[model samples]
Target: MVKLIHTLADHGDDVNCCAFSSSLLATCSLDKTIRLYSLSDFSELPHSPLKFHTYAVHWCCFSPSGHLLASCSTDGTTVLWNMQNGQTLAVMEQPSGSPVRVCRFSPDSTCLVSGAADGTVVLWNTQSYKLHRCGSVKDGSLVACAFSPSGDLFVTGSSCGDLTVWDDKMRCLHSEKAHDLGITCCDFSSQPVSDGAQDLQFFRLASCGQDCQIKIWIVSFSHILGFELKYKSTLSGHCAPVLACAFSHDGQMLVSGSVDKSIIVYDANTENILHTLTQHTRYVTTCAFAPNTLLLATGSMDKTVNIWQFDTEALCQARGTEDQLEQFTEDWSEEDVSVWLCEQGLKDLVGIFKMNNIDGKELLNLTKESLADDLKIESLGLRSKVLRKIEELRTKVKSLSSGIPDEFICPITRELMKEPVIASDGYSYEKEAMENWIGKKKRTSPMTNLILPSVVLTPNRTLKMAIDRWLETHQK
Candidate 1:
């Protein structure tokens, strides 16, 4: 089951869209600013709000490289901001005649494209922010746009229910009706190549709309190497019109959110609904799936962003270690940190990261397995006060990493429980917090407030050991 892990509360107005990078998150709002947050713990990052848009910022998009953020606005400008320093790197200005509604990075991150109110899609170069090319949607008002996984085809949906395609050279390729009503959002699924059918090469395109339906299209290359989008199937469960849709990074699952205030997860392979979540109080406007893990984020008109997790041991193990943190820290330069470590006789700690490239925060995030996959550190110990200081830092990183394991977390406090104890019930909880419930407040179990048999809390030695071991192994 997908569970709510965190709720971020910052945006004052409606959050229109959210973009996920490997380690960071960006959310643009009607508050006229784009804010960045740490995906590790949903903590708001410092020096954010790449603010300058005159009106509500409609969408925030991360480049494929994850180092740049582009925020488009109703004011007809797309500002590309540097992810590290929150500085405006470049701005793509469009005619004041139209608001740039949607912008996306090409698969290569070398180019960015956006659809404006004028029914024109403009492509800009990343380096100079110059016009690389532009394509005009010849039919009706362009409501949504996206690039295929291969970057060979560009697709757009219009207010008149028309869908248009363009080749890499910006030539009009095809135009057709994709929905009975206007299309709101669209995404191309990551290819499922693991089945190893060499003859079967196609990606699924999931689009949601005002018609309260989701259409999965089989996008494939034609016999002449041309591209084509074939209608596959329709998914309907939302009682109200669908607003947004997103695919898991691996393209195995698809999730849709709607005005009905419900979110549905679908098995992309079988086209069946996996789970339906009714946690949002208002219309859901934005939804995103983290690229590296089984994490989903949904933002709604309720002024909140809900972070959900689809936890599985296999999914967690499949996530890759991020390689770049050279630009992550605030004060210390990447090379300077490495030099400081070596000069301070802490090269062994540097070796723990395996990769030579990392910053202070990234180094703190290294897991025990990443530090010593072969049990090389098993035989090693602090053996000194310096190493003991590093152990103290383990507590500090508890706030920076993704979060503590669910098992170690206290149910009531929703924080890591250092001193766990079992109550009359089978469930375990933090010693002091549980005591406050039974003794101070004279209440019963929080999970099930049944009459306490006897307010006697016993140490859960087994769980305590596991928590201690986790802390020890993560002591940097």
Candidate 2:
């Protein structure tokens, strides 16, 4: 149901991780920079570059409180940043890994977890800024890890397709082959169940991998009071590897982003294809749900991030407008002015216009209401022209105020106004005095002086006065 609004090109290379706050979106790219952009205007904001990393940044996430951000890079370090000022809060480094693959904050924002290609997952206490523990998984790289919503449990998935669930005591509670290929990403749902049904309800886990499969699992309590795994479903729609998967906060829907350059939305209960979003031009490496479930954010190798909003009501309203336009246009006819007027009236009521085969003569004879609608449409086309003229005038005013030379100024005073005053006799003279001397009271010296050399000013002045008196009588 979500519609794509706009695509923002914020990076020069692959955008690997994207997360959203209430009004802003943060993206980390292989270009080794993190950029924050405004979700409202799609304009880039001042961002802090993570230059400490010598290579690509693989993962970035915002804390639950939206005040801090955590990022992991190929430089084998995980860093915490203050979101408001973009200052580094802490940095945890590992010596063994070539690159850090994933980093995440605990639900309570007390701890940070990071996975590395060296097959080790390290946990750090945010308050102490020290390593809590390091757990190693053999055979393949540790690619994905996440803490449970209650902060009582955590899970990690690796390149060997193994998933391990651990408790707060660092005791491994569940370990198994969750997939046939390397697990790329995993997320826990936010929904909680009653205490008596805790084990049955906690069965919700969504995982995606290089094998082009998304498996949903339910943890069921056994008769012996131990937890057992039950495969609820496998979503297999992506033609290429699935890179990331996340469940909505309510656990009603699931979103998966893939290297196939598409994101898929599925019903959590039936695993039905709800939508296939294919706006990205390259591989969609990451996707995240906005704080509001109505919006989804996607980052891609195309170096763009897109925000989609789900608005069924808005879409329905737009469709209704189109239908109204169609119905009115079909009923319009030239022979019936009343019918034409009715259709035009209906269009006006709906704030739309439908005109076909309109002629200049008919346009000229249109009623005031219809003419106003046409004029409104015409004004829309002239918006750019009006804006350009306003900009030109603003520039001219600025230049004049800054003492720039202009041709439209009076030569003597250098002011932007009309002609100069001239003195004629020993007494202080003005245009009124010169006109009275020539007997043409309204004529200035420039006019009287021109006639004085060729003809008598008295006869010329009398002829002008007779013409002016006759014109004044006719105007009355």
Whole-model lDDT values for every prediction: 0.73, 0.65
TM-score of each: 0.64, 0.63
RMSD, every candidate, angstroms: 22.8, 32.0
C-alpha-based local distance difference test score of model 2: 0.65
1-476: candidate 1 lDDT, tens digit per residue: 57999888798988899879999888888889888889877788888767899998988889888999988899989899988899899878974448888888889998888888778888888888898887787666676778888787778887777778877777777777777888888888877322212232356788888899898775554324354455655774676789899888888788999999999887665444557788889899989998997889898988788889986753333221111122233334556456435433355755543355655655455455544553245544433423433332443234335345544667667687889987875567899999877667565767557777878888865556656766776557
Q: List clashing residue pairs in candidate 2.
A: 203-219
Error of 2 at 282 (Å): 1.7
TM-score of 1: 0.64
lDDT of 2 by residue, 1-476 (tens): 57898787758899998888777788899998888776778677666454556789998988888898888998989988887878888888965755899988888888888889988888888888898987777658888887777676778899999888776656677778878878999887776322222222343778889999998765433222444343444675688999989887666678999989889987564344567889998898998887754678888989988888877575455445433432333333343322223322222322222333433234224444443455354553333433333233333343335332222222223343222122221111223334355465433334224333321222222212222433454335
> Model 2 misses residue 5 by how many Å?
1.0
